[model samples]
Target: MNYIYQDILIENGDVVLDAGRNPVLIQDSAVIAQDIKHAIIESGLSVALIGEKSRDGRADLKKQIELLVEEETRLVPGTVTLEEPTLGNIWIFAKTREFGDLQFEVKEVTN
Candidate 1:
């Protein structure tokens, strides 16, 4: 089974998940990272990989994600922010987490 973070469209400066009935705000680009972070530790899912690829804080986020993945541990609650969205695929479930350079199926913008 596959779980999709539906109603999320990352435009220039807009990234938010409709989440259907509940409007989930993505705020900025970091929002994606925040969501991944929440989905991991809070989801009760194990981590496998996490890291960033930039000269900014992004690199730090990447490293952190990777650490959690390798350690198979969850980042303490409220350790990550649900702000902007990150660009990449962060794999996490009820028991594992992995980072990949692959792209997942995101619904096309309809409006």
Candidate 2:
């Protein structure tokens, strides 16, 4: 199967197909953890594909959702703010140490 990293759409464990018929997987926990780390280092954001119901007659498809991002929060300096209605997501923030290491803090935000 081929992987499309930029914009992925998944509903639970299902893969959403693209125009070119490329297969996309939801990826397990281990892969997801690594993906989040890479995304934070590379783009400052981690994106995931979540399966959502299609209003139309098409099959259920996944939509790209931000799993983590620096600006998702109201974005106070040294802080991240997320505006979620149900607030079921967990976010983690990390600061880069002088030695090029990272120190992390986990926050749970709920509406």
Candidate 3:
């Protein structure tokens, strides 16, 4: 699959992207995450949604990540091999609910 790389930034608990793409209005991080998952699955991309960390020290990041990915994919980071790069829409959702900074990358894979 070919992928268009996009970077996402979360500041003060809001999602922002470096690109000029239209912003997703849903503020709930979990719902936004689901939107991204749906976009990926609907596009049949060879990409995985991952959660790196959380602000709450006691939060179960692992469990949260597990819930995000579900049983559909387990693609590890840096393991995707693309033949040709192509542009496509990738919905990215991030949460910075604890006054912490967050960053995410969305690989808009094309098959």
Candidate 4:
């Protein structure tokens, strides 16, 4: 069986628009990437107080993200690491049954 996923593309919290002002579409890895990114953002907001200052905190956040993504999307999560804690940079690695390996980053902005 062939499985293909597709959705309207969104960028920077806004729906991407073309020259004709039509919503752009994305499929496969792009769709999955957005899904994972949304999951991470939601997880971060849900656990706003959880800082990645300690190993346990990082692990907890990672687990939370994994659970969220797994429950929300088709991607199977791999390793979630805080590549740069100062800037709130998080790296996520996951894969879908149809789309091999996937990697992306989510950055948390603080005031």
Candidate 5:
């Protein structure tokens, strides 16, 4: 599953993530984390969405993260890999009330 998607709407803790194709795993490489943060920030969503592969959870989560030493801004820190984890296509939610049982579409970020 590819981890690529696009953010079409974000406001008042609500997101309309137009998802598709999944995202690209960018670990231990030179794809600056701040850049990713900037992308998300510019995309207008402060909280990062997280969802496990084999959980009975929805795809609209909001995560409050802490910052590391060198990294600017903050991030939804990585966790123990899901037993059947699918990379990149991290799910997002605002609240159980705000967004429920919805998978936003992820569009490509064309340069």
Candidate 6:
């Protein structure tokens, strides 16, 4: 059986509304991306508490994110990567079943 996921669209911490002032609904791959985005954003525990300055902390954070994404969404295992381009910002790259690739940036978590 196939499943179709649906959710309200959100951007930059705000719900996206259509011209009629109703929340915009997204389906399928877009919903998957949104779910991934929420998982990353809501995993708000400080990396410092997890030892962010050390290699172990970074690895731990990556593994934690991978687990959270898999737990929260229908994304296939091993398809998510958490990258830090600069300090305090994580870039999440993932692939959905139908969508080729999805990327999200999580910014400014206190280190």
Q: Write the per-residue lDDT of candidate 2 for residues 80-109, one digit (tens) a residue.
A: 332322222333433322222232322221
- On residues 31-102, what C-alpha lDDT tens digit does candidate 1 reach at each position? 344444444444332222223334566555545544553343323332332222333344432222233222
TM-score of candidate 5 to 2 decimals? 0.20
lDDT (0-100) at residue 92 of candidate 6? 71
Q: Pick the candidate with the highest TM-score.
A: 4
Q: Candidate 3: which pairs clash?
A: none
RMSD of each: 12.4, 15.3, 16.3, 3.7, 15.8, 4.1
Q: Write the per-residue lDDT of candidate 6 for residues 42-100, one digit (tens) a residue.
A: 76632442356778777777778767776744666678787777776677777776667
Q: Top lDDT: which candidate number?
A: 6
Which sections of candidate 5 miss by over 4 Å?
1-31, 47-111
CA-lDDT, candidates in order: 0.37, 0.33, 0.36, 0.65, 0.29, 0.70
True-structure RMSD for candidate 1: 12.4
TM-score per prediction, in order, is: 0.24, 0.23, 0.22, 0.69, 0.20, 0.68
lDDT of candidate 4 at residue 29, scale 0 to 100: 83
- Give lDDT for model 2: 0.33
RMSD of 3: 16.3
Positional deviation of residue 101's Cα in model 1 after best superposition, in angstroms: 16
Candidate 6: segments with Cα more than 4 A from true spot:
1-3, 46-51, 108-111
